[model samples]
Target: MAGSLRYRLQPIRKTKMYRYDQYDHLIVKERVAQYRDQVRRRLADELTEEEFLPLRLQNGLYMQRHAYMLRIAVPYGMLSSPQVRMFAHIARKYDRGYGHLTTRQNIQFNWINLEQSPDILAELATVEMHAIQTSGNCIRNTTSDELAGVAADEIIDPRPYAEMIREWSTFHPEFAFLPRKFKIAISGAEQDRAATAVHDIGLHVVKNAEGEVGFRVLVGGGMGRTPIIGSVIREFLPWQHALTYLEAILRVYNQHGRRDNKYKARIKILVKALSAEEFARQVEAEWLDIKDGPATLTAEELQRIAQYFTPPPYETLPATDAGFEGQKTDNKGFANWLKRNVKAHKVSGYAAVILSVKKTGVPPGDITAAQLDFVADLADQYSFGEVRVTHEQNLVLADVKISELFTVWQAVKAQGLATPNIGLLTDIICCPGGDFCSLANAKSIPIAQAIAEKFDNLDFQHDIGDIELNISGCINACGHHHVGNIGILGVDKDGSEWYQVSIGGAQGNNTSIGKIIGPSFSAQQMPVVIERLLNVYVQQRTEEELFIDTVQRLGIAPFKEFVYASPIPTGYTHGEDACVY
Candidate 1:
């Protein structure tokens, strides 16, 4: 993998990708050139880490525990096969053989030479991608549902609005140096699959009594040292005024969000301090003056941008395809994979397939260069050359034809991508914790792997139903542990590592933070703890209820007793009063 980094250094190849327009290319190109100069200046001792830190961060470069990590944003979590191949190229040339896909719909290359980062950015620019605004105190990538346009339950297509936000927030003059980083997520479906309630700003596409589309805006929701649910500021804002309203919100946040303390600088804190109603009043006042200004969206402009996201040329067919059904019945493996990985699509005779990267014993979201190329090939062969990255750290072939489902499943299975665990407990969302991150209090990957191995049986997982098991190395909540149906956080007491458990936390229509069960336990006890929780759910659940439903119906009290009944005598009970941040 070391020598392979010199993969011909080919010029970036263009593909049929959405939102990679001339304007995008130009902006990325110029930013790359600027960063290259900045790197040169730093190497020449014209700047120090303090001076060069922000410059590197805005470009998505981070000084990790071992080396620099570059986060490449996949705007709206959409990508093309050609762009994926470029990722493989970067993996071979500049870093290791694999990259980590993040919960925020981006990829992180963990091993990179600071000197060659500019060259890597230049290569990315050729393919109409960059690391701009992927980090820093500005609006990060605007993520939407992985199944946005193709979802069977979508009310509106969110890609266009997400892309618009990406453009507006990229290096915006007034917001570039905000008090804290901001994340925005939009969901156009009835179910909140995008975890919008946990973002800095969450927008849900809704319809007014007039039958016109608008946005239901929520502000201040965040997870970190302080996890708080966002508050609704606007019940209904016209679609055209979405951008202007967002600008008003940001302006108020930028002006008043505390900068003296980093922990309290997020817009969520500001909104909490001012009260949602007061914040709304201030933003409304600010919005009235510039509601119809240049940033206001126009109808023609929306349609123009939307054209890029229109569904592919789907073939008209019957509601049920005989061949697809026959293939499913004939092959048990395909049947299981279809039952888990394949989801109904808006288009008849088509399905959206999730490529599970969370296979047991493997790091939840790690994929190698060779596997990347293979998945890229699969995307080209069956999904119109497009792929979507899920917030769960998996990939999706969102528009696979039902007739070709068997073929796609076989190909992916051969490459170890068909784990048949989507939405299951083992389909864990994990982070590169203490193993790679400097901020992690404990190692996350190993704990996740341990739990995954314990519950690796497909039959057992299917019986458990949907469970969102998320783990984070620290309270930073990068793994979004707070929102997982079963959340685990790694905490370091003195020098030993232990994990704390939470229950009933969930995302979607009924978003709520999980309640911590009890004292932290050793990493080895994670599987036993999770098993006890599942056992309690199995015993108490009525009919065929889901995990979250069972937990909600019978409060966390039941499971808390099951887990902490005979506490392990490790003396890690200091967590009794520990804040579940």
Candidate 2:
């Protein structure tokens, strides 16, 4: 209690966010104490490196290429201003002066010291945060849309359901160890902003014709060594049975999933090997046993969880703000930011704003301690002290008033957080790659930077239109290259880094994996290869067609031809399997 963190500042008004209860506090505090002892024993040479590896991993501490990495979970991407300030504190005091926001809706301190991990956890505990289940063979963070409660197109607020799943999965005895790591994503919006299709378990909130709410469940979809889109196992699962149904699926996976090979251990492989129909049948049989068990959610229980996600208090105002429109009309930069970064909100006078972390030179999701602190200040002033971390590695102020758009834009621009390229080609989703991760085959950040530099012009990026370009340093697909409109995968060929290019991949309602254009390219050739692919798209695209639309219409044939049309530049050979001209 002596070192407990106290909130010295508060938001102007009450906002919807999950608050910690006594049980949550007890669990986190106990885990911290246990982990502290584990660290002590390891330091005293009682536990070997091999013995401490899994223990540290379970607490979200990884020994990376350079140093120990501490991953702190931000459940469903929700972050209070106070929590963010604590992140800044950790970044400044424990790790480097910056922290990286990961695609899993978690934050990572890549330069952490092994001995300071328990201290870091202790600091996070004060803010009601932890790193549990962030690693190891278990269910990782349950992510959802950043604009969950505020999205205009939302069917239902997904935070409650996501929170419920988080509660059920955390420290479950049966799932303490699984065949491999599992990921789950839920989206209630008509547009699948959460990229649920490529998760182990994808839950889409839907309403039946009878006006009953339920989930459309998809299983076994993931992007990794073997990228496959998930198949829908259930058309409609009643909300009450969500947990029981999830338990059934996990049980089926736990029993049948492969253990001999780590590569083949994910539920996706099992679902694919057994076929979706067979897997569905197995899950259904398992579900029947616990159909109406104690896990069944009641109306009262739903309300209790749902109340935490209720919309914040809002003042009555017209949908359009005249002054905001006039400012946008006068300033081209502000207009572009408004068009690209701002999204419609459920409330008439409110909007959801994406603060771009994809600045041209910066790593895709890296934010400095100063920026984090500034964002906390901004959140307190403009967005009710709440910020959301997007799965695409951006931050969001979910409840900004429409009239305050210009002020928010100005403040964020001064902080280098306003890049005005949310959905553009330059707005890339990239992994830390060989720069940090021991598993990475190549450096992903440089490739992203190369592409961003080549296409540095804002006008050019805007002209090219909305495109999702994802880069992964390895086949692990942490950057989710398999689902990008244009996917770039870093590979090792003959002990050198090469990139494999894919096109036509997409997330959302019509999720599909990208097709390999032809062969892998050298790191130097990645930018050129992307340019050629874009050239094909620009030349062949019909009126107003997006890059993905053009790829779908023309297929990979045209793009492939253009990429390989020219002779291989001197001194460079495609991989061993490539057809060298």
Query: Best candidate, TM-score-wise?
Result: 2
| Per-residue C-alpha lDDT of model 2 across residues 1-581, encoded as one tens digit per residue | 00122111222223488777767788899999999999999999999999999999999999889999999999999999999999999999998799999999899999998788999999898999999999999989999999998899999898988988888888887887899999999999999988888999999999999989999999999999999999999999999998889999999999999999999999999999999999999999999999888778888777777777777778898998789889989999999999999999998989999999999899999999999999999999999899999999999999899999999999999999999999999889999999999999999999999888777889888888999999999999999999999999999999999999999999999999999988898887777787778888888888899999999998999989988998545243334213211
Query: In model 2, what lDDT does residue 45 have?
Result: 99
Name model 1 segments beyond 4 Å from true. Answer: 1-17, 567-581
The 10 consecutive residues of candidate 1 with the worst lDDT sum are: 1-10
Query: Judged by lDDT, which candidate is best?
Result: 2
How many steric overlaps are in each model, in order? 3, 0
Q: Which stretches of candidate 2 lie over 4 Å from their true place?
A: 1-15, 568-581
lDDT value for candidate 1?
A: 0.87
Give all candidate RMSDs, comma-separated: 6.2, 4.8
Candidate 2 clashing pairs?
none
Residues 209-243 of candidate 1: C-alpha lDDT, one tens digit per residue: 98999999999998888889999999999999888
Tell me model 2's lDDT, rounded to 2 decimals.
0.90
